[model samples]
Target: MTTKNLLVELFVEELPPKALKKLGDAFASVLCEQLRTQGLASASSVATAYASPRRLAAHVTHVRSKAQDQAVLQKLMPVSVGLTADGQATPALLKKLASLGADVSDPAAAVAALKRQGQGKAEALFYDSLVKGVTLDVGLQKALDEAIRQLPIPKVMTYQLDTDCGMPHFLPGWTSVHFVRPAHGLVALHGDTVVPVKALGLTAGNATQGHRFEAAKTPVVIAHADAYAQTLRDDGAVIASFAERRGEIARQLAARAAEVGGGCRPIEDDALLDEVTALVERPNVLVCQFEPEFLEVPQECLILTMKANQKYFPLLDAQGKLTNKFLVVSNISPADPSAVIGGNERVVRPRLADAKFFFDQDRKRPLESRVLGLAKVVYHNKLGSQGERVERVSAIARAIAQQLGGEALARQADQAALLAKADLLTDMVGEFPELQGIMGGYYARHDGLGNDIAEAIEDHYKPRFAGDELPRNPVGVCVALADKLETLVGMFGIGNLPSGDKDPFALRRHALGVVRMLIEKDLPLDLGQILATSAEVFGERVFTSGPMPSETPEGSIGIGSIGVKIDPETIPKVRDFIYDRLSGSLREQGYSAQEVDAVLALRPQRLSEVARRLAAVRTFAALPEAPALAAANKRVGNILKKADAEVQPVVRPELLKEPAETALHAALEQVASVADAAWADGDYTANLKALAALKGPVDAFFDQVMVNADDPALKANRLGLLATLHQAMNRVADLSRLAA
Candidate 1:
């Protein structure tokens, strides 16, 4: 087959910068996949995606001009239905052959040529045919149409295109088209020839426009399919590759920051970098400055305003502190860049000033004063106001702190929890919801609250996502755990559980956060106790009588109550939910599923012990006796479960008439004492490894003894012996779960 590289481009109005990269990648990948599926492109063909502010293009190598013809064998029908008793073609078979473009003039010959294949109860007739290959023109048209239909466009625009009245294809003055943006041009080339594909109300050509203001030529002509990128760069003054443009911008930013030479560097934010790259065709990094007085506000406020509103990167000093200087990425380059720098600086001043104003107004009253205002803000219709939620959180925090520390730490956590949500009523937080906890911390310091309380307020929302930092101080840990537990218990109590991917309340994240804090912080708190305390704090709120409130009334601030009751069964569900999240998290951390299941089956209350237990199980699994012991444990569990009466681990030595039972009993006594002692001292690894010595005795007892003997006393004695073995092996984890 003759092959050549293929090129396709779509020029449009400026696209959404955040979605541009994804759209470009999807367009190229989908188009290439479609061609490969149709056998027009080989499996080894490579695809390169090109994206700029105004264009999306793809170049695929080794695409054939036409797909090869194929031979197809299709089953027609059963022999009984397709032919008469004498094997002559029936009218039905002749009509089917006519629809398939087969010559029906000689029906007998056609019937004789049909192959016989066996069906379930009878024989079936098969027909063979040749399928013609699809030409490049038709195949490209289908590929282009389907690619355009599947772009991951954030939103669609509807516009009309001007029509050429003299053209035969025109029906009226204008034609309506819906696309990501208004399509102005499309280019499709195979080797050096135009492929003549049409899409989005435009005919394919070999020319496309370049940078709107900086292009060296208008309607740059692409010479060949392989020359698209080079042609655009040389004649159109456009980089034409999204990744290349991003790399160029990063290089310029680094160079300019180094030239400034005060240990200065651009603040690192990939999302901001990507957005800026999508907004420019040719990036020119320039330095701009703001008034130093604005730095009096929190650096977070200033940096966010610059990056979010003006799309600029704020410079940072050696100490990771924001400076008044910032970097701007402009699309056009000029001999003297003073005009661009001044324009960006002027545009950014007002945004920074707004942030400063909000900060100033927010500090006028202390965070403590904002507490009353939260009463007017509804948190949830079923859960009451933010003020009520604060109260519940405060109670839970204090309870946890008292258990972990003394009264002093308890007081600090209680105070922090009380004011944590007060910032939601602040002007700064109201303007930027992302700064809620941060603003609360600042306001607390302004009100002369101690650093302990202020830091706790700031750190209460620690670990907002996976791998995020945890609370820095003990007080913060208490409050964070309490806040998360309250949400889990209260939501589960009201039956608002997450189903499938619908986790509107983010209960999964909250549960994971709680698990991380407990395990990583090495806190000795029991998960079940924390859940019960959190549920008690909710009191009658979980039992409010009505359908769960999905939305709050517009313009109404007072807390509303749902009239429903909390079911007693909801507590166990909440516990199971937490355990499920813990299990998944452990697996993601590199533990195998069997190891995790064995440890979690015990449902250990102290999450701090889970990691140690898992480690112990991993060590035990490598032992030579692990398999046999695990199997024996599984057998013992089954026998005890099936026993008619309740079987206890206590065994009477005199009832052990069998020698194997007596030997197993002696081994269990020695091993259980040693393992139990190690477990009490927290040496879980050593505790589990001690059970390896029981493999020999356990196998012998199971092989020689009948647990369901006709004599009730003997059977009970055997069950007790097995029960003792089961208890000894499962101190760290359920060994049965490790069995194959």
Candidate 2:
């Protein structure tokens, strides 16, 4: 069968910049998928997607004008029900054959033509027939409709169209049409011929409007399915493919930055590039500059306002310091180009001025002065004002600091925690809540506080997102841990837990932050104790409250004010929650699920040692003695569990009656001493490797010595020996988990 390439395009108003890429890919994928499903496209076909600010298009190769006819076999009814004992036609069988348009006019012949197989009740009658092929016109219409329905449109708009289904109308008789935008044109082509299809009340055609103002042709005409992209680019003065347009923009940005010399480069941000790519069809990169005075403001404030408010890329010098000049990706190119550059420079001056003004005004009041203002702001109706929360955080910080650092560290941490949220009241932070910790750090330096306190305040919210860096100094770590733990304890205590993806309180992120800091920083703090201290600061009311919070103010013996009414299970649940977060983190770092599962099963209190334990487990699993040891360990655990009385690790040597038991007892004593020494030195790998000595004894003991010996004393002694073996094997990780 012969095939020709196919093209489909939807020209609408500008799409949402963030959703444009997803919408375009989805449109192309679904349309081609539907075509293949209908057999109008073959396995050899390839689909290419094209998206611009105002258009979404797809081109497919090896698409047929009409799908091939297919032979189909359909099951009918049970053989016994369809035919009589002698294989004669039954009335019911003839009726079913008639419904299927089989030649039931000759009922006996039709029944004779049917095939039957299987035995007894499983036997069934089957019919075979050839289905008619579908033409491109009918198939394209179905595919086009399905593509539109499946688009990941961020929002939808409803408009009206006339009776002819080709033009918009607001008249009484018009039909309502809903879509991402009011689509003005639709194009569908097979080779050079138009495939007459309609979508969103628009008829498919060969002509589509290009760039709103800069097109070389009024309505760019696509001559053929294969020529669509080239013709549109040359006549429409627009880059039709999103990837090509983005690459062009990036290349221009880099070339222009190099021309600027002095090692200048545009700040790298992929998200910003994607959004800019979605906002333009023909990108024209231009250099623009602001007054040097604006540079006096923290570059964070200036860079943020430029990127967020104006969508411009600020240039950085060799030291990674922001310069006065920035690059803009304009949508138009002019003969002189001076006017476009001037217009952008003029537009950005006011935005930069506002940032500088906010910075200057904010520095006048020390962060300590703004501390009182936080009391007026609502931290949470359940957790009281931000001031009360600050106090709880300070208390937690002090407790953690005393354990990690000393009096000097505790004092500085306490001070940093107190001033951390004060920036929420600043004009700069008020305008951009994302700059809360950042602005506080800047203001702290102006108040004559040392860099230690300033950096701690700034980094209190370190790791606001995944892959973000942790606190810089010990003070920062102290405050960051305190703040996160306070929120977690308060929220979990009051039952404000996260369910599914709906984390309004970001409890999961907060827990993950705690885990990362402990493990990565190798902090010696106990997670359970830290949580208990955080809970202690909240006092009796919060923990003792019913299952749900009281919905009342805190400090009044009301469980509701502290948040929800949590039960006794709250603490354990929170602890489990943190470990779950740890498990996921470890897996993402390339550890196997079994290794992580085994290590976490023991509930290691000091999270800093988790990695060492995992490494040890991996080493042990590879040893020749590993499989037998792990299996023996599993058997030992089962025996201990079924023991009628408690099986202690302590064994009475005199009761070691069996020879197999005697050998295992002596092996464990020697292995335990070596493993204990390795464990003491934190040589977890060596500790686990030392267990290779016990494999022979363990296997022999399990095979020869009966754990359930008829004499109670003998059985107890054997169970004690197994119990001792189990404990020795699991110090680093539960080896039984490695068993297949």
Displacement of residue 603 (Cα, Å) in model 2 is: 1.1
Please give, for residues 367-405, the per-residue lDDT of candidate 1 as tens digits: 888898776676666776688789989999999999999
For model 2, residues 1-740, the per-residue Cα lDDT tens digits are 89999999999889899888899899999999999999999877899999998999999999998899988888989988888898887889888888888998886789878887788899999999888899999999999999999999888998776555644553535577799888888888899999999887778889998888888998999989999988888898889999999899999999889989899999999889999999998999999998998889999999998999889999999999999999999999888899998999999999988898899899888999988876666666666677778988999999999999999899999999999899999999998888989999999999999999999999998778899999999999999999999898888876788988899988888989999899899999998888888877775432222222233356555344343443467778889999999999999999998899889999998999999999999999999999988888888888888888877998999999889999999998998889999999999999999999998888888789888889988888888888999999999998898988
Q: Which regions of candidate 2 deviate over 4 angstroms?
A: 79-92, 162-173, 541-567
Tell me the deviation in Å of residue 601 in model 2.
Answer: 1.0
Lowest lDDT block of 10, candidate 1? 543-552
Model 1 spans > 4 angstroms off: 119-121, 165-175, 541-561
Whole-model lDDT values for every prediction: 0.88, 0.89
Worst 10 residues of 2 by lDDT: 541-550
* TM-score of model 2 vs. true structure: 0.95
